[model samples]
Target chain A: MHNFEFVKPGTVADAVAALKGDEAQALGGGQTLLPTMKQRLAAPETLVALSGVDEMKGICKDDEGRLCIGGGTTHAAVAADGSYPALSAMASHIGDPAVRNRGTIGGSLANNDPAACYPSAVLASGATVTTNTREIAADDYFQGMFSTALEEGEIITEVKFPIPEKANYQKFVQPASRFALVGVFVAKFADGVRVAITGASEEGVFRWTEAEEALSANFSPAALDSLSVSGEGMISDLHGTGAYRAHLIKVMTGRAVSAAA
Target chain B: MELSDSRTIDAPREMVWQALLDKDVLKNAVPGCQEMSGSPEEGFEAVVVQKVGPVKATFKGAVTLEDMNEPESLTISGSGKGGAAGFAKGGAKVRLEDDNGQTVLHYDVEAKVGGKLAQLGSRIIDGFAKKMADQFFTNFQEALEGPAEQEPDAEVADGAETGEKKKGWFRRMVSS
Candidate 1:
């Protein structure tokens, strides 16, 4: 790994200013960024650690019942917080105990790995990504696999996830890493249902419209019985086939609905 | 392991086939492809950086056209190495059929990975491979659809979903 400067900022302003260089990247939990850097897949000249920024930590309910989560909150903290069950559940399953203790909400959303659990949760919850510059909807936040709408040096301050009337997440984890091989997060709002999928697609996390349509009608596992996930746009690897993943999507969707119900 | 999948695009077969060759379309569709372009010898070349869990690797590779039936069918083969991360090689056979006015592109792909990636990763290779194929085709479909404002009226299989709900109080949690 290349030698790089590490700066722990006491405020968001300092952190933002510290990210001026082209080779500078914000370090949240260091869950994803550090590993990438160590592997030399990414070699940033500097890492602006956000742990010292007290403003970017914690979770609270907003005036509208939406949960406002500081980007720097750890997975262990989120998982232990009973108020945000969905988000907490996601935090608990990120990688392992050590990873959870160090990973942050902002890091996960910014990195946006296709199989990562946080993306699915955020998308399903219809969250808004609040950055120092602007707020981005979850739909627009994820650009593609391992990509996000975040511009260079732009830091994510917080995320706003609408607490659904009923919601649950179910993932068939890759045993070793505990990453979702095919993870599904389903949430039902007063108006309809939102189904987000990670690990199954090539383009990171995406909404499962067919399952949503079915669940929107009844919000039950049986509602999705007739729906068959499209194998056309999925990942086929040594672990499973495209067709098999499509099958798992349905089975998982059903399980999610059952759990939520 | 061998893995394959495809999608029916809402356009003419000719248009869909042309979109397959378009650099911008491919750049938008291929996962982790930072740069993509057509090479000499009826092939495509790209630079990609892949990150799965704690592993990350960069690859520069080319996809050669093995067989071409124009708007009807084509076969593509390629391979890449990501230094310590690993290496991968694969081929895909694509067939285009006209369903009414729309083009249905059916593809079957077989891929293999070796080195640290194959040895350390779990049984989720199929899942990852399927996702990559889907990204390619979906990007292909979006590109062929152009900047059209209206969503295409098409029939497709069910959509995929991922779930990561809250765990019980006693469950172990991984951060970030």
Candidate 2:
């Protein structure tokens, strides 16, 4: 809540330069950072706003045929984009209308909340996180709960997702917050199948390899019947027990696969 | 809310007990601890800042160790006020056991939050508390294992590394 400088950079280069200050932080939609500042939990001396950067705010298919979403692109834009039906549907449901309109995909992925929806899609879709400095594969990008492989002062420029043969995201939302209490994202490709679960693990979003293997062989909800998710690393809280989340993981995954199939 | 966890440190029980009493180690081990004062016998006072999602608050609190089990067990209870954000009161029963040459530490913690934080939902609060406990144990374990093992070359660059890891957990708990 203390006084701080705010700079809206016109380009990614300027934005990165503005973030070079001692306590400077990147500002996306202010959906997350603003509230934290108001509570006085985070007192950055300067905020380098990325919203004004033109190069970081669009969605398009790259020359390589991968779907590329600029980091500064809002959830609302992603929701409206018809090229990827599953991703658009998932984006439309993120945190009601206000959050969708204000929160940016870059902010969501950079923050990497365990219950956040973006990580599931990014991980399952086998995306690449393009930063100001380098490109990080999704597998290496997400380290753990709210953690990523991004170095200090690194800015995410874009996220590239390879369009899958079939993909779907199913989120079992917690009524109060609307966050995925347990969400599953299933993506099928010519090479194989990938399944990622969010809002369940203590460590954060992770691939359900066993379910992926089963579904790879038989791309149907019934294929998940014999596979069981263990509660070993699942989170337990007032909302649900670890066992319940483990059960929901299977249920959600099954639903996602069924929808995708 | 109540939480129970156990961790084994690669050191003797006596060494672990001494490390727990060391103010410097405790300050570093505690997540977001800005300042700390006092002693194990008379009690300790500290200022800690915690952020879950968009909610952040600085808490000033006091803790006292009760029961006289030497290096075996003790109970720590404390309370802190974070202005409009809320207040939290909690206590933990800690036990240390000898596992061959190493020491096993077990803690049973019970805590309650009132005000804006309580309204945020127990699930988020539980997640934050769990992460804090985990971070503390990790730091404590690292301290007990000695600083000699830390990479000398990267020590200068460790400030950002430590802050990022700590921030990651906080952001994770709240972003959900």
Candidate 3:
């Protein structure tokens, strides 16, 4: 909206350098940031584009048996990749082709919109978020809604997810925006199960620890028969009430667990 | 919507009430207040800059103290316009109770927004309002507990200026 300098850096180092400038913000896929700018909600002096940084744009596996995805990788790319089936499936359902094509995992995580898809996957998988400087666990990285442990000018270079034996994500689609009105990602590992939820909290993406505990004990939908999600601290808007989201969390988690199991 | 919270400050209830009348205390307690000046009775002119996620706005408005019941309870209300961004108005009812040497401060806040901001999701608006209200009260509590500010002799000054016109909330700035 306002006249601003745009720098498309070729590498993460260069992008980091570019962001060190006064009032400069990193540009990911421009899915969230661009619209925010157009809305005049945000006006950064400069935007350091990460799209040109080829170093941060792919998916692969490390020797640790972890699925490592470049933060700059587009949702479309993640959807296309089959290395992590649950993540891929989750990515495929994000918005339409236009958004998936342009939205980056780094942008989504960094923005940490409460309704975003990627957070649930990363959190559920117990993924490691690697920035230019250091690696942070997903639990520590996501502080709250639209908040993160990211420092100013910090660049997320890679995300390492320990591939689960079986996993699935179930999201109740908010028809208008296609964002998860309430989404649950259920991942079952050798040790236990992790259930992370998005689009349902006032506090942003959070793991359902009670459900995690129950589901871990018995990897079945019936294991959750006695448990119910509390409506407290849930996101209540025109799209859905907190009570509605609380109910959907149970339903979605059940669906994910059934599918994953 | 509505939000309520309470905090206990080491300051006396009377001192806490006097601090409420201080624009300096208010400016510091407000999350992003850049400027705050003027009398509580006539209202204070304030400029506050806030950033919620990606949205940033500079809001300029007036804060008024209404329905004051001495050192017991009072309402602080403010409305701000942020150009094309929109406008936000909110009020908080603060009640102070004496607890030996300390004071327990309880506040209930309500907020409303319009224009471009109202279009933003209610979840965000509600969350931000809660955070702001919490921050304001927490800041006030901490400030009250911290090193003391000078005792405001505003009442004597008010009596000097008001003469015999009125004895209530009509506080006139006196040239000491």
Best by DockQ: 3
lDDT of 3 by residue, A1-261 (tens): 876898999988899999999989999999878877888878899999999999998999999999899999999999999888889999999988999999999999998988899999999999999999999999899877888888889999999999999999999998787899999999999999999999999889999999999988999999988999998888888888899999999999999988983
* 1 versus 3: better DockQ goes to: 3
Shares of reference contacts reproduced by the candidates, in order, are 0.27, 0.29, 0.54
**Per-residue alpha-carbon lDDT of model 2 for A1-261, expressed as tens digits?**
877998999999999899999878899988878876776656778988999998999999989789899999999999999687888888998998998898999999988888999999999999999999999999988866776787668999999999899999999997777899998999999989999999998778899999999989999989989878887667787778889999999999989988984
After superposing candidate 3, which stretches have Cα over 4 Å from the reference? B146-176
DockQ of each: 0.17, 0.26, 0.46
* DockQ category of candidate 1: incorrect
* Better structure of 1 and 2 per lDDT: 2
True contacts kept of 3: 0.54
Best by TM-score: 3
Collision pairs in model 3 = none
Candidate 2 backbone collisions, by pair: B53-B174
Which scores greater on DockQ, model 1 or model 2?
Answer: 2
> Model 2's CAPRI class?
acceptable
i-RMSD values for every candidate model? 4.7, 3.4, 1.3
lDDT tens per residue, model 1, A97-199: 9888999889888888778999999999999999999999999888667667787789999999898888889999866567888999999899899999988
Candidate 2 lDDT (Cα, 0 to 1): 0.82
Ranking by DockQ: 3, 2, 1
